[model samples]
Target: MPELPDVEQFRTFFHAHATGRTVRSVEADPTIVRNTDPAALDRALRGRRFEDPDRHGKWLIGWTDGPALLLHFGMTGDLVWSGEDPHRHRHDRLILAFEDGNELRYRNMRKLGGVWLAHDREEVAQVIGALGPDALSIGRSEFGERLARRRGGVKAALMDQTFVAGVGNILADEILWQARLHPRRRIETLDEAERATLYTVVRRVLREAVRSYDYVGRKRSWLTHVRGIPGGTCPRCGTSLQRATAAGRTTYFCPRCQAADPAVGSGP
Candidate 1:
């Protein structure tokens, strides 16, 4: 699924190309639009100019002169910009044609996540009300407090959107690995110091991801460089990375680096 950083990039993309541009036409797939149908979306968005967009967690909110557009790029979804004679892929769920003849396409293959049209601010709140504080902006104290409330594995707690929005499987593993904490480590078992360390690590990792457009494979030191490859070794140590089901998602970590006991830890 698209996490916070990815969605942030999408927000930047949308703001650069679509903002302030009038929508010349609207083409939407009904099945890929939530909260409203295709005809309604067209009626609401046509002739409106897109304003600056905001991102909360993995959701993108696009404010127009009229209605609001909400987008969630599930597991395999992305926003694409095309020029003249664009080859419209079959998976292009939503297409917004601009007055300048440019196009912004919301493409998704699996169709797990979709677009939503909100007529008012109340409707927008209703859609995103369930999400917790965005991971990027949550305070350290609040972050620790929320994690302390989770009685499950630390990895699972991080992956729970209700606990702290925008973290998914890949980010959870990366954060935990960097913090030198095991994926199976119980949240309740972490001391204040450990929790503080975790808070710092989360902020650092997330910010690094947001700053770098090509973060995942750009650095050899990042675990994401070899997350799921065959015989992938730890970036810190030479130990072969291990994989298991944590938080119901495939997790990868270095056994030697991320010890269950903090006392035996490699410094984060």
Candidate 2:
């Protein structure tokens, strides 16, 4: 699934190609248009000039002078730009034609995600109201406060969208591994210093992931490189990594590095 970093990349790409450009036309697969029909989507965005785009969690908001276009990339959705006569992929569910003859396509292979139309800012807020603060925008003090409030395992707290938005299974695992906290360790058990380390590591890991464009571009030293494979070893130490279910998702961590004991907190 596309997380915060992946959505940030999509937001950047959307802004670069569509900002200040008027929508000349729209073609969409009705099945992929959520909350509104295909004709309604066209009517809302047909001639509106796109302003700077914004992203909240895994959701992408295309701001315009009128209605806003909201997108959730679900598991396999992507936003791609194409030339005037660009070959259309079969999975291209949504297409927006700019006055310059260029096209922006929302391609989804699995069709799990869809698009939404918001006529007003309040409508936009209604869509994302359930989500907590954007993970990247949380300050140190706020992150510490949020972390301190959670009674569940630290990994579960991190993965909960209502606790802190944008973090998914992959990011939760990466953050815990980097912070050297066991996935099942209770948040309250963390000392002040440990909490501070977690706050710092969360922002650092997220910022680095955003700059890398996506998780696949993460460095070899990152646990992501080996976490998915069987018998994978920790990059920090040569110790064999362990795998188990945490927060209802498959999780990976170096047992030697991130022992279950709360006192054990040492990481690169």
Candidate 3:
């Protein structure tokens, strides 16, 4: 799943590579672009230039003088610089061909997310109205306050889009592991230092993850490296990392290093 870091990367890329470029043509798979009429989209945006790349959580918005192009990269969706092959890639759902012969293509294997047309940023807000303050933009004081008011486990609070935007299941685990907190640790049990640690680590982990480009280009860490693998052991404490479905998402944490959940098992 594309999170804040991933969408931020896309936003940066879109600004640098595609902004100010004139759209010559647009070809879209009708099945993928759900919100706007294909003909209407092309007519409204064909001659316009892409400008002002912005992101809110996992959503990326690139706009022109006219309608804004909102993108949500679902599980397998990606926006890549279109290569030579045009029709060869079946997943290339939405392709915006530029006047310069280059293209920016939106591809999705699962079709979970698609393109949305918004007249302005305010309209984009209406589309994603349920989202709370962006994860990267909120200050530490606000983050602490939000967590202090939450009744659920810290991981669940972090992963809630309505509470704090952009974090997903994988990121929730990574941030919790880095802060040395159990996935099921209640927010009320957090001390000032622990709260500080969570806030600091959340931004740090996300920045590093985006800087590393999806965490693939960087050295594998104890927390991020264990994601998606079954029965993976902790790289830090050498403990068997336990897994459970917490708040409906699969959660992973080190038993020895993060045994702070009072309701669950033995703790430090």
Model 3: residues with Cα > 4 Å off, grouped in runs: 83-88, 262-268
**By TM-score, is 2 or 3 better?**
2
Ranking by lDDT: 1, 2, 3
- Lowest lDDT 10-mer window, candidate 3? 213-222
After aligning candidate 3 to the native by TM-score, how far in Å is the CA of 130 from where it should be?
3.2
Scored by lDDT, model 2 comes in at 0.88
Residue lDDT tens for model 1, 75-167: 988998996337899999999999899999999999998999988788998987788899999998899777767797999889888888899
Of 1 and 3, which scores higher on lDDT?
1
lDDT of 1 at 45: 95
lDDT by candidate, in order shown = 0.90, 0.88, 0.82
Alpha-carbon error at 188 in model 3, in Å? 2.6
Model 1, poorest ten-residue lDDT window? 259-268
Give one digit per residue, the lDDT tens place, for model 3 in 1-268: 5888888888987887789999998888877776787887888789999987889888888889888888888888877785544553778888888999888888889989888888877888888778978888788999988888888688878888889899988888888888888888788888888899999998888778877775732446647686656777887867788887787888888888887654455444
In order, how many clashes per candidate?
0, 0, 0
Per-prediction TM-score, please?
0.95, 0.94, 0.91
